[model samples]
Target: MSGTGEPLFVADGERDRIEVLHVEDDPAFATVARRFLERCDPSLEVTSETDPREALDRLEEESFDCVLCDYDMPGMNGIELLESLRESYPELPFILFTGKGSEEVASDAFSAGATDYFGKSSDASEYEVLAERIATVVEKYRTERQLERSEERYRRLVETAPVAIAVHRGDEIAFANRAAADFLGVDAPAELIGDDPLSYLDTDDRAVARERIARLLADEATMESLEERYVDADGNLKHGLVAGSAVEYGGERAVQVIVRDITEHRERQQELERYRQLVEAMGDGVYALDADGCFEMFNERMVELSGYSREELQGRYAGDVMTEAGLETVEAAIQSLLDGETDSVTVEVQAKRADGEVVPRELTLTLQPTEPGESFAGTVGVVHDITDRVKRERELEAQNERLEAFAEIVSHDLRNPLTVVEGHVELARELAEEGASGEELVPQLEAIADATDRMLSMTGDLLTLSRQGDTVGERHPVALAPLARDVWSTLDTGAATLETRDPGQVEADRTRLEQLLANLLENAVEHGSTDGQSSPDDPVETPADGADEGLTVTVVGTADGFAVTDDGPGVPQEDRDDVFERGYSTEQGTGVGLAIVRTVAEAHGWTVTVGESAAGGARFEFHTDG
Candidate 1:
């Protein structure tokens, strides 16, 4: 369809479309060239431009598959135009067509980025060769453009990711995309592009990181992970988890490092460690198990209570060392916990020790969820050796039965005789009144009344002691602050002052917590004050050291639970274990107060311990589930 003498046009019907631009001064040659291209492929869209300047304008206006230009023209020579077109669209295939083809001119065209050079020859099929060469160059250019776009998209994705991503070449940081640059506190990746990664690490960690990277590159490991310390832009040391993997970069082998900040996680782990230590130091046993009911961890007290060595019990199944019935009970308790039936479960069972001895233990299991959407993995159990407690309870029960029999005998059999004696005394007093001796008999009657009152008080105390273990109170979250205030307000000793600090909450029995607080407050007021006065000039000084004003009560929350501190004389180290025993008071009052506190706390499955307070006095900490 091109005019006569115009370059031959090719139509590639198999392709979606084909466009060709032909520039020639002779209309006759363009006509012949276009016919030859159309015969090669019937769908060719060939446009002929006789004016060289017009051809350049057309090329600027539209995209063409290939351009065929003649060597000689009126205003612009073909070689000059070809040089200009290559500057703008270097990848567009250009073929020089000329009537006079010299080898020197052809070499010049090829040097100017021409695809190929050809001459109008006598041979009939020369135009066909030119058309075939144009098809090859155009297809190659399109493929190259697609590859460029794909690489561009991939580069953009890596630059915008949230996690730090870096590329390394040998030991140098070759590229650290945007996220990694910001994490390392650098202006751009270029700043660190050529720097060795060791420069960013601590002196001691540099060799370690380098070795890890080397091992990764050698294929000895798929990935290497370590905790690395680095000085940030602010010159402060920061902790991060460094993970490295092998990669090929820029035609050379390298390793990629991913740094993640773990400062908060590390701090939390340290806090848990401190809590574990505190629990291990206590008299009660503590055990932490994993999801499969295997012992993941346990404190020394737990090992001692179960009579098992720590090495022997760790990683063992709980059911293995327990009696068959005990194992069944524990499994049911664990199943209930997993099914969300209860937050905790308590059961008394006998456990076989490492030496094959069986001990009675009261195990209280509390479930803690480590992550959301995960099954109840394990329980933290507090086990107490209650064999001795049970023995003492039985002894006290027998004593109570004997006392009850004696009371019944005295009231029914002895009281009648005593009443007759009192009546005879009263008649004697009346007769004496007539004889003027009633005043002397009045004193004797008053003594008998005093003795009876003392007996009644003793009976009341005995009854309270007997009923202590029989009562099982419901447990709940009890806030310590308001409870302490109530206890302080109820004490009628005007000379003694009460001061309480802010206290958090703990899961415990409200009545028992109040009772515990009252006992401790009364103890502090009685022992830390002189002549019932809490003033500075009192004979008994504050137990706290210099700059401390006076005895004060403070309740504080801890990782395990809550603790009550008092700025009063602390219990002697030797007496710490004995202070919880019944009738062991150092003061004049009966010693059942602290004993009651212990009994109530133990009933709720909590551990009570004595330690030094921050205020330089006794601290009683109760570990209740919070």
Candidate 2:
């Protein structure tokens, strides 16, 4: 095929279809150029043009693998044609084929965007050089095009990535995406070009960030992910997590950062940590157990209480950590929670601590499942040391036993003597009256009888006071108005009037409540009535203390509890606190009346405060722990 007598062997890969155009002033030379290329590869499809102008025009309408144009053509020379065609197709393969072979023409053609040049000869062998030039230029063009396409795709991928992405090389910033611009508090990434990324870090954190980057670049450390504070647009610090890896960017190796905003997540983590610290620092033991009764989490207080480290308690069974008695009660409570029988449970256990000190503890367990269904997630336990409570209870039992013994003595031993004394005084009075000789001794006999009766009454009152220490557990709804009226009927109110109001219904001891009311009413009549009538003891002239009667006592209901007040002489503020003492008494009053009222209220879990009444007298209000 060529004068050199060399044969062409195509490679074992798929051959590219080569399309080319040839131009010359003579039609014969155009035909020759086509033959030279076809001889190089049979896959070549070469179109020939005799007119230089027509060849340039045809290029606009069709694509070609390579363009071959002759020098010294009519309208355009080889170099001129190369320059003209390159205006539209700069990368189109163009080879100058010319009979005029000179360094001047070759230099001119190459400078005018010619891909290669050929010295046209009369010998057909010279055509081989032209064929080689066309193939080489086309192959080079194809390689460059593929590289451009690959680079384009990579750019688009980074641009549309979800996280904020940036490319930085040392202190120079190369490129950044839209998210990166927003994250960096800039209008565009172009503004960040050639700037250090550490500018976004706080002053104190910048050095740390720089160290991390240095380590990553040196391959000494992998900064795959790190959380750092970044200053926002307003110069306020925010949290961001930087992730991703080193990559080649902008013709140099750079670190490609994918920044994620973690401000909210970090805040939540901080709050959870604060709550954990608070729980750990508490005096009570706090813990959580999974459905299988294995410890899920336990605060520091729990570790201290159990004498175990945080590591020792991990995944350990709660029952296994507890003493036998404690474990039994705790497990029962947890079982009740799991069975959906109770929302919470409290049990007293004489548990042994790590130091081998056995003491009573109150274990309160609450279920915390995600749903209301029977599926058990876990339980939260709050433990309190009830050792002091148990000690006080034991002491109270002993005191009650002694008081019961004292009450028996007062009821039996003291009452029998007072009964005999009263009988003798009555017999003496009868003798004075019947014999008619000791008329002068009758008053003395009557006075002695009165003293014995008063002694017996005081003995009975003391016995009642000693016995009311037990809680008022036996209670029924008792209408207080009817009870007040009934108690008033028994009271000897000489010139005092009783007023009853609807005190609602209080759950109280029927007998004890009536006794409490009786004491309160009797006290009102004794030392009451600022507008004083005659004292039962004095029989002296005193003004009436009420709008109608000597004194008025009111028993009425309040929101939480009830009150017994009187339009009578109120206790002074200074004496109010001492009035609850057992031996406390006022002028014209028995020493034991109000003290008895306090004892009954305390037994019923009620509190009383002394205040001035609306009528300028005593207002003893009973407030229940509602």
Model 1 worst lDDT run, 10 consecutive residues: 530-539
Candidate 1 segments exceeding 4 Å error:
1-165, 169-171, 177-179, 186-191, 202-226, 234-236, 243-248, 253-260, 324-342, 345-347, 370-372, 404-626
- The per-model lDDT (C-alpha) reads 0.70, 0.73
C-alpha RMSD of each candidate structure in angstroms: 32.8, 34.0
lDDT of 1 by residue, 258-342 (tens): 7776656788889999997899788888888876577878888887766667888887888777888888888888788777898
The positional error of residue 467 in candidate 1, measured at the CA in angstroms, is 22
Minimal lDDT window, size 10, model 2: 1-10
